[model samples]
Target: MRPYLFLFLLGIVLFFATCRKKDTTPTPSTPVVPGCTSLLAPANGGFVTTTSVTLSWNAVSTASSYDVYLGTTPSPTTLVGNAVSGTTHTVSIPATPNVTYYWYVVPRNTTGPASGCASGARSFTYIVISMPVSLGYHVVGYFPSYRSLADVPDIKFRMTNVVVYAFYQVNSAGSLLAPGSATAPLAAVATKARSNNAKILLGINDGSGDGKTNFKNMAASPQGRTNFIRDIMNVVRTNQLDGVDMDWEFPTTSDGTDVTFTSLMQELADSLHRDGRYYLSCAITAGKYAGGIRDAIRNELFPIVDFFNIMAYDDFSTTTPYRHHSDYALASLCLNYWINTRGMPAAKAVLGIPAYGRPSGITQSNTVLSYRNILSQGGNAQLDSAIVSAGTFTNYTIYYNGQYTVKRKAKLSKDIAAGVMFWEKWQDATDGQSLLKAACDTVGRSY
Candidate 1:
């Protein structure tokens, strides 16, 4: 009831109100420590193979050990494993194919009874391939002439599982014949092959020779074209051959032949498929020119044939010992380009490896040799590299130092499709060690 007492009460009330305001305002929380020092493996946002992914990370500072966890939801995670005083740790994840998984790491400091939780979680995804396998091979076939037809049964029987065989010819001069009417035996041999439960492909390719021009004529002219198709189909029907393989040396518009060659191939594919029989295949040239043409083929025939065999070996020749056709780099490069960029499916592509080498004096210019012959000339290791069976040619290209080299064409076979097909069977070693065998093993092919 007195002014002094009333004023004193008001002051007390004002002071209490100020204190309440300060207490009501929230205080900032300590910045939560980050999860782990660092992470790896299915690296940050990485794509990985296999259902179990290994999650790893560096241990946090002042931490004596680490613990890892993963889950589909946030926090209160499922622990994967714990490591002691280590900078890094790996945790195996059990996940289904094509599913994304989230994981995190926690650091444990000896000072505390419990380990500290990670600041956040890291995530990864997994992909599962049905079967990841490949095939490889050396020379496919070899026949001096029609006289070699008698050897067809022997060759096919001997190389029971050979998927492809190259046919060769000898001109009137008795020299190795390039593509011509002289190589007609191919059609008959292919027929015999089919009857024997084997597949045969004629060798109609000639690298770095005028034979390319002859090939263009054969593909362009109606008569030559019909003969070519007839020879192949006849072999298919009579010998029961599985397919026809075109081995034109190379097709380039530089000489106005690229378009024609492509047209020929498309026409043949259409014709062959219409019959509802015979597999159509081809050995596309390797390197820039080969690569360019293959890109065109993929656009034209990705859905046409059984597979496209790219001759990846011999980027260079014996003349350039440092560079040659069997160069692994070129082989891998062509494979990646076609499969990854050219829109060709991995299963529909085959990488060609040489069974032989070029003589040393030969230049980067295309030259081929037989693997069997190269083996006798100190190329044993090289030949062995290809993992072949009998009835496959060893195209012998001479290296500069007389140390002949063979291409280990098998490496890619197990990872790619269709398998390796070669140029000639006669050029192969008769000792039962041939490229066909190697390829069969790699791709799990039988017969």
Candidate 2:
């Protein structure tokens, strides 16, 4: 009995010692952060022109938090937010026009940086966001379909005037065809314009063909011209389009094509005005060298079309050898030529501003760069300020209009022209530095 008791006591003592000893074996290490998938927003190569942007991503399985990097740099180093517990982040950046930003998610676990999920990077360019105010002036914004259909809420109340470009394009055969990829939200655009008391028009341009030849051929006889008119009316009625904008590039050349173009304009204006609700406008050549657009302004085009949109950028063709393309000097010279020299009515002129850029040595049409592209590639906004002050930036030869330049152009338009028109809204910065917004802020500020 004593031996059995001793054995039991020894077993009890061993059990107590085992329980008291610290367990040194480590528990499983924290799991690594899983790779992120399904990125959204800005739609990959998406561009925006606005004051604020929202960034979003899908959830990572093992991530406890996320780190967002955003900046103009290709690899953004600016930490937008660190250890963000959620998946969405909204950033309110400067309104500096034509800026592009790169961003990505670095999802992490509790462990450390090495445990972060390697999500890839994405980019978005800020184009013009909104035109804040209009002073009863014609602020014609050409909304291009190269990008997404811009939500009309962004500009309807402010710009109050938009052209959904481009509905029909002229083929080499001199036939009018639907500009399939370039047409934007027509119904929505009409709805917004009606609601905001804005005027929305549809644009027709010479597309990918000999526009001069097409115009000449179509106008040589009444059949081709009448068919074109018929199509225009059909589209205008079906879409509830308030008007039509004829973008016949360089129809007023020294060639006889100018005569035919004039006739086409006459017929189009007559047909559209027959309804009274439809207005007929045209985009024509600038006064001098607007790059490839050297078509001399003719005194004849004025009475036919309701207004003229001068293609105002790409002044690099000046013999002075100055690097500036869309500078104050060129705009001044063009305005003088159109209104003062050509004897165009100030009420019928719409100053045209380019939303694209021509880098040094790029002269061809394909060589053009959108303002967003220039900004995405580190265009100098500081230089833009110099340009606004009637100065020039010599460091780089890239040609574009910034926030300041755009505003000044608008003021100039207000002084001499009845309205201001842009080649495109897509090309302007979608946010704070937007050229269109600059025009809106400057044109009506005094009023």
Best by TM-score: 2
Model 2 accuracy (lDDT, Cα): 0.69
As a whole number from 0 to 100, the lDDT of residue 435 in candidate 2 is 70
Error of 2 at 183 (Å): 6.9
Tens digit per residue, CA lDDT, model 1, 118-213: 446667776542211222322244344433555334543334433454544222221234344544355555556556655454444543355466
Model 1: residues with Cα > 4 Å off, grouped in runs: 1-188, 202-209, 215-240, 288-298, 317-319, 360-369, 382-408
Tell me each candidate's TM-score: 0.51, 0.61
lDDT of 1 at 363: 38
Each candidate's clash count: 61, 24
lDDT digits (tens) for residues 1-447 of candidate 2: 999999999999999998896988998887875565455886777766566788899887788888888888777778888888988988988876567788887877767543323336787876543212322477777766555655334553356365545557766666777756544556665665567666677788776665556666666777888888888888888877777888776654456666677777777776676525577788876677443344434567676567777777765652343476777787788788888877888888888888776644434445566776667767754245121111233333556788777778889989878777887766776666667777877866321
lDDT of 1 at 296: 39
Model 2 TM-score, all chains together? 0.61
Instruction: Give the alpha-carbon lDDT of every model.
Output: 0.54, 0.69
- Which window of 10 residues has the lowest lDDT sum in candidate 2? 385-394
